[model samples]
Target: MAKAKWRSVDGIVLLNKPIGLSSNQALQRVRRLFQAAKAGHTGALDPLATGMLPLCLGEATKFSQYLLDADKRYLTCIQLGKRTTTGDREGDILTEESVPSLSDESLESILDGFRGEIEQIPPMYSALKHEGKPLYEYARQGIVIERKRRRVTISNLTLVSRTADTLTLDIQCSKGTYIRTIGEDIGEALGCGAHLHSLHRISTAGYSPENMMTMEEFEAISEQGYEALDAHLLPMDTAVEYFTKVDLPETDTMNMMFGRTIPSPVSLDNGTVVRMFDQGTQRFLGLGQIKGTMLRPFRLVNTSEFSL
Candidate 1:
């Protein structure tokens, strides 16, 4: 018996994650289907949450930073009259409050207060590192730690619908905005606490759930053949599409590969993110940032291959 032949394919796959699966679990399933040598996801979705998780296969992993910083949109459900330890249904119920009878007009008015720039403290049961240890580790041991408030922007937040006990919301926020916290905050403002019951990420930056495929769907295609799976992959440059493109001559390409700062054809000001490409083939070399007139290597892909 011979081992299956694996082709080296590099690109991004917008994954539609289902509830109850961690982000790593979803990435592993995609990796097995593609048989990729290297793969990574731009952001981690909580096991309770679902939708647009971008999986980067092979060289696409190098551009994960760009996707990580992209704004995200989510549709979430909040259950009033409850507070959870983790701020979501997964955590133990910390307390219960009497639900206040409220109208749609009142709910909408309260939600309006959460829009725009605000400060939030990250949940304890999070992956954020604290002195070389994950905060979740301490949270599991029944230890409460003070978390610093970080500024986050909620570009848009609207109360979609409301029932007597539950409310559905649509939110567009900057990176690091936690929907669970928003639910809790809304609860606080209404004079009745709340906790997240259901959360689904509909989009991340430009990647939408409509473009995503579930793990089961991916597996079904993989069982058929690799070509079926390959058809779903987005190009490696998908995440960097917003950056300014700079075509470099072969000499500059060689210099960039060696991590050398070089002059570029474009007159970009300092600190501008730019995508680098080969002059002749227009192959994506890597990413560079402008500092004055010099192009400095911010992130390079396979430097050894392009080295002179």
Candidate 2:
């Protein structure tokens, strides 16, 4: 059997992650299809969740943190009257109760309490670490660790739909906001008890959910040719689109390539992050920060990596 050829690839692919696969599982599948030498996911979705899982390839990996730290939106279905150990469908049913009458006004009132900023204790079955091991590892061993409350902002949270046993919600919140915890907390507030019935990330980091392609779609594209696959990949600059952009002259860009801080062409506030491009060719040169009225290279792209 011949070995598959994997080369450097630089771009972002918006993957509509399917259920039954962990975030890493989905990333690996996409990476293999691209024959990418390096890749990473912006954020991890639970095996039971399905949603936008952005895959960063090669040079794009350097900017993945911006996506991770960016705000996210999700559509979640919360099942009332039952609570699970893992807070989602994957866990054992821990408690059950009769669901209360869910009227629009009452539900809105309950949800209003969760809007804006609120404190939440991270779930036991989470990837967060304690002493260098994932919290889920200890959770699997039936060890309960006291977790500190984290403050998260829910910019938008509205009831999308509701049934006798379930409530659907559209939520836009800051990064690190756990949808499962929201469902469980809402259920608790209603005296019905609750667990996450389903979750789908609608968007993240200003990337359109409409651009997300499913695994099946990716497989079909792979059959067409590398060109077809490359067409779907967004440029690495899109990863840091939130940052201000500045173009440096050829000589200054050359200095930047060597990690030198060049004078900002225009005055910029200290700590302002900017994406740099070559003034003449306009090719992306990576990112920089304005510190002490100078543009200091934060992360520079190595265009030579793709020469192979």
* Best-matching candidate per TM-score: 2
Candidate 2 segments whose C-alpha is farther than 4 A from its true place: 1-4, 305-308
User: Model 1 RMSD to the real structure?
Assistant: 2.5
Q: What tens-digit string does per-residue lDDT give for candidate 1 at 1-308?
A: 12265557788999989899899998887887788888999889999998889999988998887898999999999999898898899988988889899877877788888899999999888888899998989999998889999999999887788888899999999999888999999889987789999988898878757788888888888877878788999878779989998899989888888899998578977799899998877888878999888899988777455533
Per-candidate TM-score against the hidden true structure:
0.91, 0.96
lDDT of 2 by residue, 1-308 (tens): 12269987789999999999999999999999999999999988999999999999988999999999999999999999999989998889999999998678888999999999998999999989999998999999999999999999999998898889998999999988999999999999999799999999999898999999999999998988788898999999998887888988888978888889999986878998899998888889899998887889889999553211
Best by lDDT: 2
Q: What CA root-mean-square deviation does each model show from the true structure?
A: 2.5, 2.0
Reference-based lDDT, each prediction: 0.87, 0.91
